[model samples]
Target: MKFLIVEDEESLRKSIAQYLAAAGNICDWASNYDQAYQKISIYSYDCILLDLTLPDGDGILLLKYLKKLNKNDGVLVISARNSLNQKIEGLSLGADDYLIKPFHLSELYARIMAIVRRRNYNGNNVVKYNELEIDTSNKEVKVNERLVYLTKKEFDLLLYFVSNKNKVISKSAAVEHIWGDDADMADSLDFIYTHIKNVRKKLTEAGCKEYFHSVYGVGYKFTDR
Candidate 1:
């Protein structure tokens, strides 16, 4: 998973990012409203860990921007303010969940996962598309009840595709989602082709129907038809 930590506190942001990264997620962060806005406007993320208070603007403004753009990115507000009115406003503005400050990193991770699952997989740990099934919790894929073994990267890629089924997943989007910060150091996007080829071959060999389609001049689209 790829996440954006929109937080102001350096210690808390680093703590969250470090924990999530160790758990196989690509984590990036923003220390204030402007930085967060810049990242969100250009890139996509599976989830956003938002802080209600920022240096320049209210976090709710960012939430409204996301809504105005019709973006489906999941958001979990982590703020020092825990008043009923603040909670209600955040939730009403489209936050998936709220976490009070000075909480354990483990619980925060769990909340992020819940938001991701609910946002992408309809709140289920398992995802299904006809004969194809994915046990997200275990990172397992099966076709017609037969197991399909995939590398960590392959599994993540497949999960990404399934989660955003039938959508045009741009090359940039795929690279960012999978590589996160490492994407900047990489020279080119040619590696994306290699991964896609490998995923297609593995799924086909496993007797799964082909669902990936190349969109010329755009990106790849995963669809049943």
Candidate 2:
């Protein structure tokens, strides 16, 4: 999954990014409110790690903006403040979960996954679409009871397609979803096409029906029909 870390503390931010990346997630970091605002305005994420306080502006404003825009990006507020009212406010403002600072990174990962599962997969860790079964917890995919090997990127792409089945997802969005902020530096979107092709080949070889359709001059869509 893709995540945005809205944190000012350089060490903690880097730590969170490294941890999530190691877990096969794409991460983007923003040190202050303005940077956070810009990222949220442009890109979407599976979840966002928001710190309640910032040097320039309050983090609550960002929450309000997301609510105003009606974006479904899950939010997990990570703040040092332990006040009851602050937690209440953050939750009331649409934060999926809240974590007090000085907490374990493992706990943070667990919470983020819980939120994403709840919001996206309706609280199910294992996502099933027809004959395709994805055990997200174990990062395993099976088609018709046959294990299908996929690279991390290929697995992520397949999961993404399943999450938004039937929607025409542009190559740029796929690139951003997989590479996070690094997508901007990419010279072209040829890698996106390559990953999708590999995923299709693997699934088809595993006896799965073709669900991916390339839309000329646009992008691709995953649909049963």
Candidate 3:
């Protein structure tokens, strides 16, 4: 998953980003309202960790923008505000969930996963196709009841392909999804082919059917037919 951390406190922001990154999620950070605005306006994220107060303005304004565009990206508001009205307004404005400050990072992880599952997968923590299964909660993939050990990138890759099955995913998009802001610094999309090749080989070796197909000029598609 790709997450955008909208926070003003440098230490906390880095801490949160680091924790999520360690958990195998790509993360991007924005320190103030304008920075956050620019990121949300341009990039897509699986979730956003929004702080209610910022150096420039209230974070609710960001929520308002998301509502104006009718964006369904999961939002887990991280705020120090304990007022009832504040929490109420955040949720009413489209935040999927709210976490008070000084909370555990583990709890935040759980909440983010819950919201992602609810919004993106209809509350499904497990996703499967035929004998291939993904336990999102554990970040594990299985084929024919046998465990498939995949590197973090490979696991993320498999989830991306499974989620968008039957659709052609461009290499650039896939790169951005996996690497987040670092994708901009990348010289080329060639590295993606290597990862795809590895994933293809692993699944094939695990007794899975060929579901990933390469599109000559565009990118690749994962489909059953």
Highest TM-score against the true fold, candidate: 2
lDDT-superior candidate, 1 or 3: 3
Clashing pairs in 1: none
Error of 3 at 212 (Å): 1.7
Clashing pairs in 3: none
lDDT of each: 0.90, 0.94, 0.91
Candidate 3 lDDT, 1-225, residue by residue in tens:
999999999999999989998888899999999999999987778999999899998899999998887876889999999999999999999999999999999999999999999886779999989889999879898999889999999999889889788989999989988889999999999999999999989998999898899999999999988
Judged by lDDT, which candidate is best?
Answer: 2
Q: Candidate 2, which segments miss by more than 4 Å at Cα? A: none
**Lowest lDDT 10-mer window, candidate 3?**
65-74
Instruction: Sort by lDDT, best first.
Output: 2, 3, 1
How well is each residue in 1-225 modelled by candidate 1, as lDDT tens digits? 889999998988999989998888889899999999999898888999999899998999999888887888999999999799999988998899999998999999889989988888889999999888999888899999899989888888988998888899988888888888788888888789899999899888989899999999888999999
Of 1 and 3, the candidate ahead on TM-score is: 1
lDDT at 210, model 3:
89
Work out the TM-score per prediction: 0.94, 0.97, 0.92
TM-score of 2: 0.97
Each candidate's clash count: 0, 0, 0
Q: Write the residue-wise lDDT of candidate 2 on 16-133 in tens digits.
A: 9999999989999899999999999999999999998999999999999999989989999999999999999999999998899999999999999999999889899889999999
In angstroms, give how far residue 155 of model 1 lies from its true place. 1.3
